[model samples]
Target: MSTSPRSTTWRTRAAVAVATLMAALLTPAAAHAAPEESTPVYSYADAIREAVWVDTGLDDDGDGRPDRVAVDIVRPSEPAQQGQRIPVIMDASPYYSCCGRGNESQLKTYDAAGDVVQMPLFYDNYFVPRGYAFVGVDLAGTNRSDGCVDVGGRSDIQSAKAVIDWLNGRARAYTTRTGTSTVQADWTNGATGMIGKSWDGTIANGVAATGVEGLKTIVPISAISSWYDYYFAQGAPLYDSGPDRLSDAVESSGARAKCAAVQRKLVDGAPRTGDRTPLWTERDYVKDAAKVQASVFLTHGMQDLNVRTKNFGQWWDALAENGVARKIWLSQTGHVDPFDFRRGTWVDTLHRWFDHELLGYDNGIDTEPMADIERHPDQWETSSTWPPSDTRTTTLHPARGDRPGVGTLGLTPGTGTESFTDDPRLSETDWAARIDTSTPAKAGFVTAPLTRDLRLSGSSQVTVTATPTTRTAHLSTVLVDLGPDTVRNYADSAEGISTLTNRTCWGESTAGDSACYLATRAKTTGVTATVFSRGWADLGTYASPDKGVPLTPGTAYTLTVDLAATDHVVPAGHRLALIIAGTDKNLIDPPADTPTLTLDLARTSADLPLVGGAPALTRATTGSAATAPSFTPLDSVSAPGPAPRIPRG
Candidate 1:
């Protein structure tokens, strides 16, 4: 349900004052105002009034410059009581305008008797009274602003900064009009944070990297970290041949349609391919990690089919490398799971970060490390640092003669190989199924049952020694829990609907950080959580089974598949199943003709590192049927080896 906007402004003002005073007296300003409402407050709606763009400027050709940028600002109403300089959050989009390539009718479509047109600022009504002033601007050259859209570049960033400065100036002027003690427009003495999702998230990051003095923090949800990878992965455009790509372009154009003249001229030049371009390389958060310094709370869905999960890890890496110590939350879900207004937990967290950074409130946020990772069934773990120390290492070996139920620890070497065909037609949507029905045609691996509750978190690596006939073979790994004869996935509804979603145990990007599969969500299956899954690459066709014989049939080549880090607490008695099939059931699409491949029947073994000092599970226990056992953060686990190598350029 949409939370009813705060009913009264004075009530909100009073609460803010009381809370601010208490915080001033007892705690550091970094503290967050508790959600527990102390009094009725003003709804943000009551604070800002409807206004229209009465001016115009540049709406034109190929040049990127705002002619007469017009913005709609919403501020607290008149009859001001105590001094209150509001913190503002801004948004700007050009979804409706038609002047140059634009049409008057197209650009000026009004709704409900035309009292108010559905302009760019139409959606920011939710940020009011929550202690923020909202601004929505039509990018210059479009609607009311002046200039062509530059997507993610210097123009967008600088223009946003200019508008922010403009807002701060207007806010100061208003304070003078009211005779308040608010400081003249300067920095975040009054505090400011940027909020938005997707496009907005991207802009917010851009703004942060701009190093705007007044900007305090940012809450970018479901944002793109790298346009290059998002549009094109590994130097290849993902949307080039897919129908969804065309559909997305059409949908994206809807916003630009507001400015017909500008849309007609600029749409053609918009980026389409994934090849490295000046714009994409410059716009990448990973490439420009050092530029961002603001406190950020980044969120992403584990199975977001639209944007690659690599964006999240890349952003996290950027922030970590810059030493920003930002907070990250990776849910086991999709694009907009937590975007609902009524579901204010995300907002609540954002507010806390702002309070800590902008307000200097020490409400325990300082104690919170750079990361607040929530992996599963309602459990949140804190890490003083990311990629927590002491990550457990285990292995799964293929089934061989005389060792039907044993793991990979003590398997003998036998010469053999497993091969499957690659069918490109049938592929799984990242969020649709657990198994890639297509890739399984040639992909294969092994799984096992848990001897005890398993808590796999952070980064996982699979090293395989296999010889491929082809120059490049696509190897994939999947971790699953086999229930009896059926395969049960550890993923959840919140993580996503896909058969397998990428998981990040340590602060790393599975999609781009390494060549492996990462589980999207954390799991803690009960006594039934026995079967655990893992696998290796799907050597593409052109190799022995797919094409030419790259490997000598009897040669011993090892292939490794790395699974993403998981935070699962699988129950005892559940058998971990290692399936070594040439195909995956739900992830990658399988190739049409699978070759008959064989694995060495004799030499297969799992070598799990059993820490000498750390005790292993002596007995098995089951969690209650009512509640699944959650894997708690091991606050003090011994480090398994020297810290894993941090990725480098």
Candidate 2:
């Protein structure tokens, strides 16, 4: 059964009125009346629907005229019925007519009149009634849009920016794909907010980085900050092939033929050599973060191997440094939308966010906590900032243990050395399950069971001084929680949330479209160990992530592997461990040749972000370099090809 909308708490509206009165009391001359939306006060049943092709200055496909971006819109009849213009919410995506969007993979369906009958997700159904216009845009070279796909290049970014430009009356739009006459977005008040998940969200980051006018805010979920990092890490490629695969996937059949040249450019300029090229740099939004003027509400799954947590970590840092007002939600799921795992709260909070940013409502959302981190499955906590600003780095070293292959992690420097031969065949699951066993593939180190619950709040770094027998080698460092626990089954195709038969409606419905969507619950399973964070690098590029310096087979190199940002708690009686290995066959693409690496224990250390810092770690210190029960060999565990839980990168 489809759910129906009920009265919302509208938590921030009362605060908005209070703040407005205070502002008026403080500055009587400067204060003006801002619209206060108390509820879904408008009617979605009579919402106006239309489509337009906005003009982008770029001729990416090499056609004579400028490329046009297709935009499908659904807006409450404020301008038509009430004679009032409203703000806009846009999701410019390549997935609109391709892979689809949201948990149900909802696609746009048009009526015989060529107008959109249903827009994917609940944005339109929910927001339109709240006095906001929603537009679903087809990215350049995809769907009904003009020009060829350039992936995340100038063409792609420009297509979306052009829509914002049109909404703000800075660019042109037409009623049809190749229409000569222009159409104006006169009904919009020009304040625009962009939001999406995955590639769609990635475009939000790119567009916001451009600092384009009229873009008031963005909500990017599981988005990418840099194309280079998406495919490679520290001069090591994450996968084979090039960006053309993604570019071709989204383009329509007719457009694919026209986009052949653009696809070729993507292939030719790909970061296949593991070196950041002009192509990758052009798509690097982090470098331009300082120019961002839009407030951001970002979300990412801690276990998303697809886009990776590093993307949000880096982008968030940049936005913070540049003083871009921002809020974040970090979940334990993998590449899943917050709507799936946190439906009701997601809609409520998001409603407040859009009201504050685009609607210019004086909601106290900005005064609230900046980060909402899900430390465990369905367990959420708020902080003033991510990873807690007071977190301190704790350095731990690896030393020989009582067991043959196992080692201990301690507060003091280690005196001995350890060696591990490269094994690209084994996956992370195998390496983690076999930590205590004697193996040439990896070197494992574990700490004693913690006396108190210790939390790792942010990105950790593993510095390794190793002499490899082979000139070309790959290094991978993984941080693991060594204890039995039940966690969201991110390995599942659903990315931790199982869609339920029951439906929940967010807004009004019509004969053709309803705001009802299948509800979801966290899909969890039991596991003895969990890989929380991991980082990789090519030994040849040990000196720098960008440039490769040739390595001598016999010489040692001090390389640092920066793990993805994470928030995890190792409860009392549980343990934490570090594993250094060669290729992670399941996650990273293996190098042609992997050599045995000999590590100088005294020169290697792992820098952990601990909320409790040094004194907190005192109780958890290894009394002696002895084998821990948690480090026992996992010979019984099996690592099948492509370990589950690696999704939504």
Candidate 3:
């Protein structure tokens, strides 16, 4: 048929459009656009839920067979449906059946048929829908796993490492504890990013230190790097107990008989003498930081006496020296999970972190700020690097004041000596409270009020020269900020954040598992005084932590005591005090016969990690700092011992 000119033009346009559509369908870009959903690319409610027993090469229970750890997995259904694979986010925790996980203490629940009905926490609920699998692993010797608890030792680490190996096709996984039917992780892309809190997170650190090839990244929250530092601080025995108690506590469902011998081995290896034995060395992840192939995303509390800030500080330092990619969040809470204190933001940030690290998404997450610090309650600030990347150490000395047991900290060292006898019943709070008064337990020294704000952004130390009246003495030193400020009421029953009745959902949920969680708010209190940092050391370990040499009576020894790491800003017009004390009761077991220590003021000094060094400190204490605005003065936190709770899962 003959067509008009306008009809011919329309026919020609239609032919070109058909050709364009065919070409676009064959393009790689169009293939990627096949899934048009905005994330939630997979179905959480219909995910493939399964379980496996990964065989670890060690048998700590001496059962004459290798131990097999239980791993419960939930991956998106889209992997099998659409023929796509995804990475994994694993939380290998011993608390899966015992004490529970996260703030609400959620545990794994199973169906009547013995299949995993629910996985605890928001990880599976949130990440599974976003094209990630969540694996809740019962660490060997806990839950349904067949082994003994080695605490943070070889068996404990290998239990989780075996899971990573299984994913990478390097190890075998079975359908049952005693079955020969093997299961392969063909649905997974073999990239793992382990994340957890407390003991679970400690395993992540250990596994990463193993230089495992499949682990892409790790998010360790309030984790321990060294078992030695956990039980003792610089040779000062901080706890009366050891790993034996922790190992026994998490061996859920009464399989304790098998682990009894392992517990005894733990106690035997970890002596009360505070010496770093082979047991502590094996548990220490910081030494193997160079072997880590995965990028690290770490979070820790400034006032965390449980896992403590030293663990993060030392581990972060080691990671930095080894040139490992890392990011961090420093909170103000005490021994809390970021999920409880900063839930919504934490979930989102962690999602992005996992996406960028594991999924190989060039999302510019690594190019962003490396550190996020909660300076005050619910207030946060970001930086390119921690300690502002410009920090320097400034030395402040204790000078004698007119009153006995009261002194001043100055740029110049003071002559003469000051003495204080040890007290067995006092905590750091008691000594901090009586800074202005004369006390036999402690000698306090204060600096002139700062004229401007001064930030302390890293670890600090005190070099002390003292002569003991007896054969041995314990030394405890603290840095206190004597001014008004608002701090988290760690004194609160809940430890800083109180849970609210309100709830919010972060992702899609299943019938048995939830993406919703109770809200939490920072419980704050106005305080005139707060302990910024403190440290303790036994005189017997003065020469070295490896050896406990017998101290000579009336003999002088100069030793360096490293304080906990922190990021705190001393406001203008606030005085920084240094307290010299003995036996921070409840923190360390006190000796029956306490010794008196004579401190040579001229030979002692505190090395502070100041953001701007001496010049900034001089400007802050000299000029405009005097008349600066201040907060309302109130009582400080009246807590018991620094760490009254156990740090185990």
Residue 312's lDDT within candidate 3 is 91
Q: Which 10-residue window of candidate 1 scores lowest in summed lDDT? A: 640-649
Q: Looking at candidate 1, what is the lDDT of residue 40? A: 15
The lDDT leader among the candidates is 3
Candidate 3's C-alpha runs over 4 A off are 1-27, 30-38, 624-636, 641-645
- In model 2, which residue pairs have backbone atoms overlapping below 3 Å? 306-649, 307-649, 491-645
Worst 10 residues of 3 by lDDT: 1-10
* Clash count of each predicted structure: 128, 3, 2
**Model 1 clash tally, residue pairs:** 128
Model 1, 253: alpha-carbon shift in Å? 7.7
For model 1, the stretches where C-alpha displacement exceeds 4 angstroms are 1-46, 50-70, 78-83, 92-127, 137-146, 149-151, 155-159, 168-190, 235-237, 241-274, 339-344, 369-386, 392-416, 425-440, 460-475, 483-649
Output the better candidate (1/3) by lDDT. Answer: 3
- Best-fitting candidate, scored by TM-score: 3
Which scores greater on TM-score, model 1 or model 2? 2
* Candidate lDDT values, in order: 0.41, 0.81, 0.82
Local lDDT at 425 for model 3: 85
TM-score of 2: 0.92
Ranking by lDDT: 3, 2, 1
Q: What is the lDDT of residue 99 in candidate 3?
A: 85
Off by over 4 Å in 2: 1-38, 622-627, 630-649
